[model samples]
Target: MSLAPSGFLNLGAQNLEYRMIGPVPEHAPTIVMLHEGLGSAALWGDFPDRLQAATGAGVFVYSRAGYGASTAVKLPRPLDYMHVEALEVLPKLLEWIDFRRGLLVGHSDGASIAAIYAGGVQDHRVLGLALIAPHFIVEDVSVASIAAIKTAYETTDLRSKLARWHKDIDTAFYGWNGAWLDPKFRNWDISEYLTYIRVPVAILQGVNDEYGTIRQVEIAREECYCPVDVMEIANAGHSPHREAPETTLDAISEFANAVLRDEGFRAA
Candidate 1:
C-alpha cells in the first residue's frame, strides 16, 4: 500500500500513527525511528524532518500501540513488550512502508527495540543501528527513575504534560511504567541478542542520563562483534536528541552516511 506523507497505517492488529519525511523508502535509504517508552511520533517533533535533511534519507516516525493516536494497548503490559514490538510489530511496519535499505534509529525503549530487531530478525535490509539511551538490562537506577516518574505522574503535572503527546495518556504511561516497575522485570535482559547482530551500531548517550548509566554502552562493546561507535553528550539527560539536537543529529547523520556509503548515499 502507498503510504501518504502523514497518516495512520493499518497494520491489521492496530493502526499506527506515522509521518514520512523527505523521499520515500524506494527513492532513498530510510531511517526508521522508534520512540522512547513514553514517546510517540509527535513527541519526535521536528527531529525526523531535520534528520531527513541532514542525511538525505527518508525518515519514518511512528507511534506504537497505546501512544499518540495509535490503538490503545491492554493495561499492565507484558514485561516483554519491547521484544514483542521488535519481533512482531516492527517487521510488519517496515514491510508496510516498503522499506528497502535503511538504519534503525531508536531512543530508550525504542532503542532497545531496534537492537532486538537488528539482532533477532536477521534482516539484511537493515544496515545499521543508532541507539539512544538503550537498556540492555534492567538497572537499579532505571527502576528508581521509573518509580519516581510514577510518583510524579500521580502528584505532579507530568501526566497532563504527557497527555498532550499521547491520546490514551493513562495507557501510555501505565503500560510502560507498570512493566518496568514489576519485580519480575529485573531479570529482563536483551544483551544476548547483541552477539547475533551483524551490522554496525552507534550509541549516543547522555552523560548525565538519569534512567541508565555507562554500563549500557559497555554491554554493547562487550557483546557485539560488529563495529560499535559511542558518543556521550555531556550535560544532557536521557533524551540527547532533544537535549542536544545539533550534536545528536550530526553524529547520527555521519553514522548513516558512513554506513550507507556503499549504496551511494551521502549526508551533507
Candidate 2:
C-alpha cells in the first residue's frame, strides 16, 4: 500500500501517525526515524525536514502506540516494551511502508528500539543505523533522571508542554517513565542484540548527556563486530538532534550517504 504523505497507518489493533518527507521509499533510500521515550512524531520538530534536505533521502517519522496521536497503550508498560516495539511493531511498520533499503535513525528509547530491530530482525534492507543517545543497559543516571522527570511532570508545567505533542499526555509520559523507574527494569538490557547486527553503526552522543554515560557507547564497541562510528557532540545533551541540530544533521547525513551509497543515494 502506498502511504499518504502524512496520515495514520493502520497496523493491526493500533493506528500510528506518521509524516513522510522527500521521496517515497520505493523511489529512494529511506531514513526511518524513531522518536525518544517521551517524543512523538511532532516532537522531532523540524529535524526530519532538515535531515531530508541534508541527505536527499526519504525521511519517515512516526509516533509509536501510546505516544503522539497514536493509539494509547495500557498504563504501566512492560519492562520489555522496547523489545516488543522492536521485535513486533517495527517489522510490520516497515513492511507497510515498503521499506526496501534504508537506515534507521533513532533517538534514546527510539535508538534502543532501532538497535534491537537491526540486531534481531536480520532484515537485509536495513543497511545501517544512526543511534543518538541510545541506552544498551539501564544505568543509575538513567533511573535518577527518569525519577526527576516524574517529579517535574507532577509539579511543573512539563505536562502542559508535552500535552501539545501527545494526545494522551499522561499515557505517553508515564508509560516510558514508569518502565524505566521500575526496579525490575534495572535488569533491562539489549547489549546482547548488538553482537548479531551486520550493518554499520553511527552513534551520536551528547557530551554531557544526563540520562546515559559513555558506557553505552563502550558496550556497542565491545559487542558489535560491525563497523561502529562515534561522534560526541559538545555543548549538547541527550537530544542532540534538538540540542545540536546542525552537527547532528551533518554527522547523520554523512553516515547515511556513505552507507546508502550503493543504492545511488546522495547528500545535499
Candidate 3:
C-alpha cells in the first residue's frame, strides 16, 4: 500500500514527528507504533508497512520528543518519565492523532509505555496490545547491558550510528540511558499495571535477548488476566522485530487479524 507524506504534529510546546503507512480508513483499525528507546520512526524502517499489509490496518509511526525530528528535552529526565509518557502524553497524542481505537504496537521502552497506558487509562480505544520485547520490571541484565551501551557510546561508533535517527543524539541517548542507569531506577517496575490490562496481549521476545530475559514475558503471563500470546524467537536478541522481523511480524499480524475477526471481544 502507498503512504501519504510524513507530517509533524504540534502539541503545544513540542513538535512530534510522524509517518502514516497505508490509508486511515474510517472502518479499519489504526496501529500506532511506539518505537524503542534510542529508536525513531525511521528506525522502524518498513516494518510498519509490512504490518499494515499483513493486517490491513493503518499504521502510524512516530518519534517521541527528544528523538528524531521532534523537539529536544531537558537532561536528567525524571525516573517516572515512562509513566508520564503513558499517563499524560499518550492520551494527548492519541487525541491529537484522532485515534478512535486500534492496536498499540510498541518495542522495548515503547512497549512498557504502551502497557502502562492500557492499564492506567480506561479508554476502550485501545483494542489490543502488540508488545515487542517489553520490560515490566528492571533486571540486573538490563542494567549491565545499558552500562555496556554507555561504554559503547563513549568509545565506539554507536553514537555515529544513532545520529542517523536522532536530531539531538545526546538528549535522546542520555534521557533513556541515564534514567535506566540511575540506582533508584532499579526499583522501577510496571508489573502492577499488567493486572489491569483487559485487552489481549501479543508478546514477542528474543530467546537470546541481551537486555532482558524471558522473565519479562513470564511476568506478563502471571499478572495479566486477559489472554497472553507469546513468541520466543530463537537466534534473536533484544530486538526480535529487527533481528527476526518475519517471524515477529507474522505473529503480531496473525493476532491482530484474529482479534479483529472476533465479534464478541471488546478493546479496553
Candidate 4:
C-alpha cells in the first residue's frame, strides 16, 4: 500500500530509479507488470498487489526511463520504443534484478513491450504473456486520443495530476506523446517478431478502447504462433487494468495458472 524509499538501479552506463512491492510466491512464474508510457512504479497503483494476492506469484513493477522516477532517456526515441524496451532495457532489467522466468502483464505501451520481448528475445525466461489493451498498430483512435490528451494537458489539470506521480511530467508526456504522433512512427510493425514467440499469451483489449481497436488484437491473434487467448473486456479504455483491475487480474491469473499447470507447478 505504501511505496518504500526509492532505490537506484545501476543500468551499466547510468542509474535508473526503481522500487519493489514483494517477493510474492512461486505458484506460477513471476508476473512482471510493465506500466504504460505515462506510468511509473507508483502509477501501477494497487493492481500488482491485488494480482499477487490472487495468483500467489511474485510481481515485479518498475518505471522505464523518462517515466516515473527512472533516469531520463536522453536519445531521441525511435518510433518503436517497444523494440528498445524488449531488446535493450528489459534484458538489462532482468539481469539487474536477476529475474529468471515469469509471466508478463503489460498495458498499453507496456503491452507492446511485453509482446516484443516475448517474441524477439532469445531468452526463454518468459513462460507466458498477458497484454491489456495492447497496440501493435497505430490507428485513428490512437492518434485522436493522444491529441486529446495533449490538448487536455495543455489546458486542464491533467498535467498537474500526472506531475504528482512523475518528477518531470512534461518530459514524460512529450517524450511519449511526441514520438507516437510523428509521421515515421506509422510504419512501426512488430508482427514479424510475434511469429517467433512460442509461449502462452493472453491478449486483453477493451472493446471501447480509445487508443486501439479489435483489429490490433485480431492481427496479433492471427499472426502469433504462440498459444494465444483473447478477452475483449466491454466498456473500457486504454487503462483496462486501472479502470477494471479485477477483470484484468482474473484473466491474467487464469493464463498464468494454466501455464503453471503445463509446467506441473502447484497453483493450489
Candidates' C-alpha lDDT:
0.94, 0.94, 0.89, 0.79
For candidate 2, write residues 195-251 as lDDT tens digits. Answer: 999999999999999999999999999999999999999999999988889899999
lDDT of 4: 0.79
lDDT of 1 by residue, 75-107 (tens): 889989999999999999999999999999999
Per-candidate Cα RMSD to the true structure, in Å, reads 0.9, 0.9, 3.0, 3.0
> Runs in model 4 with CA error above 4 Å?
1-6, 24-28
Flag the better candidate by lDDT, 2 or 3: 2
Cα lDDT tens digits, model 3, 29-140, are: 7899999998999999999989988887788999999999998999899999999989999888888777866889999999999999999995798889999999999999
Q: Give the 10-residue window scoring lowest on summed lDDT in candidate 4.
A: 20-29
Tens-digit lDDT string for candidate 4 (1-268): 2223357777776566665555532323567888888888888878887877776667778888887777777546667677878889888877766675678888888988888887888578788888888878888888888989999999999999899888778889998998888988877777777888888889888878888888898888789877788988876777778777778878888788788667665543
The better-scoring model by TM-score among 3 and 4 is 3
| Cα-based TM-score, every candidate | 0.98, 0.98, 0.95, 0.92
Q: State the local distance difference test value for candidate 2.
A: 0.94
Clashes per prediction?
A: 0, 0, 1, 0
Minimal lDDT window, size 10, model 1:
259-268
